[model samples]
Target: MSEETTRGRAAVSGVAWRRRWRVPEKYRTKGTARPEGGGRSAGGDAPAPIRQWPLLLVLATTLVGLVVTLADFRIGLLIVGGALLTGAVLRAWLPAVGMLAVRSRFTDVVTYAVLGTAVVLLTLMAEPRPWLEVPFLSDILRFSVD
Candidate 1:
């Protein structure tokens, strides 16, 4: 091909490539919705650790609980539940919780609280001298089994 023709083809191909990779106008125009309390926990200029304190705290607590569970199941479970409960509390009260904010504030709080309560309750009701004894639960289990 002639020099001019080759250059023209190259330009056209470049344009085509750009068009193929470009974001759709509709999606580009639409604004993204940020999860509630999704901003940094600390100031914008804060260090990474400071900004993500909430997530770190929850994860650290969970890790500790898991490690403890290796030695003592009940206490470890309690600690895990407490960590989840703490996450719920922080999500509820903190204006910005960084990565801890996974959804709407209400949804996150409810999810965390429910999960924490369930864990703690189930742990307490574990076999062999259960701390929480629900008479109906035993009856229900028996009925279901029989």
Candidate 2:
């Protein structure tokens, strides 16, 4: 082919390449680069707003539970269970919790509640007093130990 024909073909191919790989309209331009302020750019979907208070409360409760663990192990387990229960409550009611809100709302709430209740019950039934006993748990522990 002639040099001019080759150059023309290259130009046509460049345009065709760009046309083939064209970005979707929604992601074409992010709002951050624009001088005029606006909400999020991707299809106008607003970012999840940060909720500080709930996050702080969860952190504080967890820290307190950790501190309690230094004194009495069984009571500390109860305190940790209480923290988990608090987290479950927050997950059920709060809209956004930054990092704490991991999984779907229903799953998170149920998981936290169940685990917390189990911890509380197990701690209560442990060792000396044995306020509430579960035959299955004792059997499982005995099997595991042997």
Candidate 3:
């Protein structure tokens, strides 16, 4: 490709990348302290500082998994539950333990644990039911303003 076209493609791709990953948006540089009024306020839908989400996500995952696992299944449940707990705890705390780029482990643990728990609960509950719903979409919207 010609130099101009190559530069144009690169610039366009950069925009796509920035939009796809809200954290590294064009206006805000990653790893720098966010401006006081830049992102969504504490009460808004804007992503929380990278500092907060993992622990929160981990705790939620732990609770959800604990509930579903407890609600169903009669065999070796404790062992499985404990393993999920370990993953959730790891997700929640590991970042603080060893500084990292983002708090995604919490999501990973929750994804695995929750999905697994759901399958087990459905399989064994005999009359499967949701322990919780998707949570308040409004609450999430309220959190992402900036």
User: What clash pairs does model 1 have?
Assistant: none
> Candidate 1, residues 1-146: lDDT per residue as tens digits?
89999999999999999999999887786677889889988897889999999999999999999999999999999999999999999999999999999999999999999999999999999998999999999999999999
Candidate 2 versus truth, CA RMSD in Å, comes to 10.6
lDDT of 3 by residue, 1-146 (tens): 89999999999999998888785456774586532223222344545554445445545655665666666553344445555555555545443422221335555556656865765554454424544334474378569864
Give each model a TM-score.
0.79, 0.56, 0.26
Q: How many backbone collisions does model 1 have?
A: 0
Q: Which residue pairs show collisions in model 2?
A: none
Highest TM-score, which number?
1
By TM-score, the better pick of 2 and 3 is 2
Better of 1 and 2 by lDDT: 1
> Tens digits of per-residue lDDT for model 2 on 54-94?
55677788788888889987878888888888888977776
Ranking by TM-score: 1, 2, 3
